[model samples]
Target: MISGPASVRERRLWMRTIAIVNQKGGCGKTTTAINLSAFLASETRRVLLIDMDPQGHATLGLLRDPSQLEKTVYEVLTHEQGVTALAEIIVRVRENLDLAPADVLLSALPEKLRETPGKENKLSEVLEEIRKDYDYVIVDCPPSVGLLTFNALKACTEAIIPVEPSFFSLQGIARQMETLDLLATTAGHNIKARALITLYTGRSDFAKAVAEEIRKHLGDRSFNTVIRFSLKLPEAVGHGLPIAEFSPRSSGCADYRALAREVLADEPPKFAPSRVEEDPEEAIAPAPAAALEQAESPLEPRMQVSPPIPVIGEGLFTVETPRAREEANSLPPAAVLEQAESFLESRMPAAPPMPINGEGLFTSEAPGAREETIPPALAAVFEQAESPLERRIQASPPMPVNGGVRFTIEAPGARSVQLAADFNDWVADEMQSRDGIWTKVVPLPPGRYHYRYVVDGGWQTDPLNVHLEPTPWGGYNSVFVLEGNNGNKVH
Candidate 1:
């Protein structure tokens, strides 16, 4: 593939999505959807809530107007459309929450349902194209479990239902379960639904009894945290602020926070995505640094990088990582191989003959048996090219000779990095190498100089240097000492 700008890769990594929905109307679904999304976004998790409902409540809750959207999810999700092409349509409503705005045109869904084959998975198809852009995608569903609701359920990995602690809410569980089971088996999306009790009350006997009844029905399926009935919830919705920002100190906000944490804590289920054929890249084992760290680290997927070079010959060069390819780019593979062979050939000097002896036991020696003469020219080159990577690696600095200073020593990655010393006013840095080596000779005056390596445009500690101290975030920092307090150079 052709190279793209780096920002394109950066926009892909922000994700961990959950679509909040309930089939029944008047179940606090929209309130839970927007507030939980807003609270999660407030926690610094990048979120995008797709409002699949025709009522456009989630859209109106987040945006100034829902029907006014010129390029809504309806158009943006078309086969001719994609996220990058429609990113301009996705408006930034709050800090990290972006809404793919929708309007009431969806109210006609029942009439047009199944006009196309497998219409339920349309949203899923579009979402898969841009799954990397969000940490959490909180989708708000329409009340009737219509075509739009089916599409959202098919697209989302998990679902959260805000039940109003009423008998009818529990009664609807059977129908909702049937929908989830059908989508999981037919559409190949095993969507998990986390049931949450909304409009909870502590003092009222009827509220307590209703909450207990719902829990008995749900058992471990319902979330442990109950959203207490509070006036702030409705007020926040009317003002278009998430309870977290509107009335953060209220119980409603706290309940959503706890529920959001639980939802975030659940593991993303492993399901086989619908595909006819898979690529070698998808089948290959993921990089341990990235895939294994997914649950722990916040790294997004890379935008563009070439595939690893297939190992050939004796495998002298191991795996082709981002570092190896970069260094290899400086010297083409053909040139590198040519140079290595030449260096090896230089070592195979012509065989020499042994010395002649006297009288009866005299033996004649051929030139092959004679002693070989060492040439100064060949000897110097031999020493300099001892290592294959040495063409890029710098040699050790000068010793404690006059004006030689052991100001500092450190190196990080192998090609094209920099280092700055406190002795140099932390000015321009000397370049570092890609073969994991660096050496610099500096004429310094007196005092100890603190130094650090600036690698790949970022300030970092040297992997080779030992004098390290803790910096911010418990990261290591390199410390340099100007021994003898005189102008000198040391490796």
Candidate 2:
């Protein structure tokens, strides 16, 4: 199931267990875990990305198809063989990056662990044996507060809560903090949490204002590096590679690398984490003094009126931010682009000529160097030949089709059409189809909804929808917004 070097050498390193969590779905929890682990590993640190989420998004995103794998996190957690003995389940993604995969079967984990004693400490106990091998353990938590999330928090020393730049995402922070307080009190786990602004498009006054407000409320907890909204981010996930491997020049790659550096700036503690033996009948330790203070404090009140940020972009491509512009100068220039060129040439067959705009090339090489460095014909292949799957989200603006929300996809031969979305726990719902077209309509409420189409058995995201996010399953999910009765009111 893995494709890399023979087993990585075990080294004595201080491990930092980080939980990338958010109660809200579609907030880049999986995305952050995958890429941040990738970037950290790129710096030569041994990183183990634990796919704690039952959806197995992090597993699929790292190029491991969960359906094809025999052993997963489900088997490890449910069986008597803890993570220390289940070394085969940890697949190597790259040189220093390893993944403990999870699958749909993991959905049954909570129930299985419920009757088991020390349920919340199971993950922590398993990790305690294996944490010494890696320099970092990044846990991708599910989008809810339950035993799974509790186990992740209990095992982690740090938490990275990704917040989308929106009113709802901003408002949910208080509840998340409360949950952390409860965990600290009951589980005796003191975690350092940092608020990371993800899917952030800094163009609008409203988005910027909301982000600033979150930073003000969170204070030192918010990360300085913001992941700019990039179409490339979702596209990378679809390609089943990290942003750096998929498109090193993309803004998504730059932002994640910066975040990695920020996370590593502080020297990790030299001491090993205290290994607490689980006692089934024992009472929980008292809450820390800091947690008591947090429980008593209220969220900082907002002073300015929040603006109505559109659910999706007005246009196809987003302009690169100033930070991205600065980062573009130093991205692995010739080596990376050359690799991409060779990859495209070998992988893709000839299609209709779609000329690439020369100005769009992300590089600073001289004209003579550009012509001589890589063949002009090969360079054209890099820009042109964008596939239908890759460019689908840019096809049209997101707008309600009928009285209800309607989704359409173009597929030649499909027996059954289905939809998987947030509202339905991502279960496939059958749709109507005629000729080479498929369509589905459902009455959705006035908030943002993320969805994808399942044509026959094959999965396809809405080509027409521009608002998109990365799924744990290594693809993009289409998002659309329905304006509430009060047009610009925040949810």
Candidate 3:
């Protein structure tokens, strides 16, 4: 069950703003925003949820009455109304919870925003006014890549994207990254990195597969706590309550709370504001913060708007941004291409051609240098195992084994799967599979035993865990892990 909030005023001291943004609809962007805000509120962290979407799903979910507001975030953005103090419009939900409701007004704000100067940074400016008032300001962005999304990107320091595990989800990340890059260059003033993975189904194989794909791409960016699918998630939202409050006992609530802790525990995001001084470069010559400025030269009588500036410090400095691949000083395309011929030759892979004259012997100084670096490959052979399979292939208790502990396999499909460990010396293999699951009840005492599972005379890794290693064919293999090794305390 969710813990009751302590107090609102006691929590605003640790305010941290976050924006939940994803252009892909049904990816649970609003759901994450609503639930995460709710979870934060439950922790007594003063949360101000901004429903920036015109659809107002977050508004309707949190509000008893949607049309009651006279002024919304929409009005604050456009309508010549400066949003100086945003806390005044906060709709109090629970003790620590407040919301900035949105509806039809936000839909009209976009059109009006298009006509204004410095249009992209309107929301960022407005939120800056209210940033220090609350512990967290979670903005719910619309389900599209438009001006509204851009504004949301500009307003927040970090972003959480909810991506459903499906075919389209991976491709959508590219567009999202491009949009984030656009904002970083233009609208994003103090914005940091933006990333999140959501709508995960831990029970389904497809979900796990997709999650693995996402984790590989995101690498360190992906959160460790994964949210499993549950029926209770929608019910909480339908009741106009946070998932933690409405379905406190549900798995969905637990997942969200875990996600909250992960989010809160993460390092705060930060982006460079007009290129600050990095370490090594600073030692040679400190770079100046050249805001877009141009100076006229008195030497030219028929001078145009501004004198021509060099690439670095000069009259009208056209700051040449470097490509992602280039780490050197900024240069034009011609310079990159001119050096590309040599670079391309170095990077290109060489392949042997078929011999026509049968005299194509290419000799090397040492044949030892050309030897393959990869280890021997091992293939996992599946033998009908349990749903949650446990194949203890080895157990090494160099000392005496008590033999009371019983391992379990939850495979519903297989009627038989045997678990053998080296502790028994493969003679008295204690654990055997039953009811599509394998269980070995034994007294595993103070030693390490390497174990694997034999299912229907075939070998396979455990479903619940994974072991990462290089394969024999210059690739990698995923392995499952079990704890309690090398005199470690047993769970």
**Which candidate's TM-score is highest?**
2
Model 1's TM-score against the true structure = 0.50
Residue 57: error of model 2 in Å? 0.8
Better of 1 and 3 by TM-score: 3
Off by over 4 Å in 1: 1-15, 78-88, 109-113, 267-491
Best by lDDT: 2
Lowest-scoring 10 consecutive residues by lDDT in candidate 3?
Answer: 373-382
Kindly indicate the candidate among 1 and 3 with the higher lDDT: 1
Candidate 2 lDDT at 314 equals 27
| Candidates arranged by lDDT, highest first | 2, 1, 3
Which digits, one per residue and each the tens of the lDDT, describe model 1 over residues 373-447?
222122223333454433443222222335554323334534545667566776746653444555555666545
Q: Could you tell me how far off, in angstroms, the CA of residue 284 lies in candidate 2 after the best superposition?
A: 50
lDDT of 2 by residue, 1-491 (tens): 11221233433446788999999876778889999999878766789999988777787788635577878888877773543444668889898899998876777888888788888887887787776688889999988889889989999999999987777787677778888998889767789999988866443446656777887788788887777665566556755789888766555665686677677665333322222122222211221233223322122221111111111142111233343334433445554344333322212111111101111111111222212122222233333334212322221223343456655665667788788888899899987766566666676667877788887688776653334566786767777655444222121
Instruction: Estimate the overall C-alpha local distance difference test score of candidate 3.
Output: 0.52
What Cα-based lDDT does every candidate model obtain? 0.54, 0.63, 0.52
lDDT of 3 by residue, 400-427 (tens): 2235554554555764576655565644
TM-scores for all candidates: the values are 0.50, 0.62, 0.51
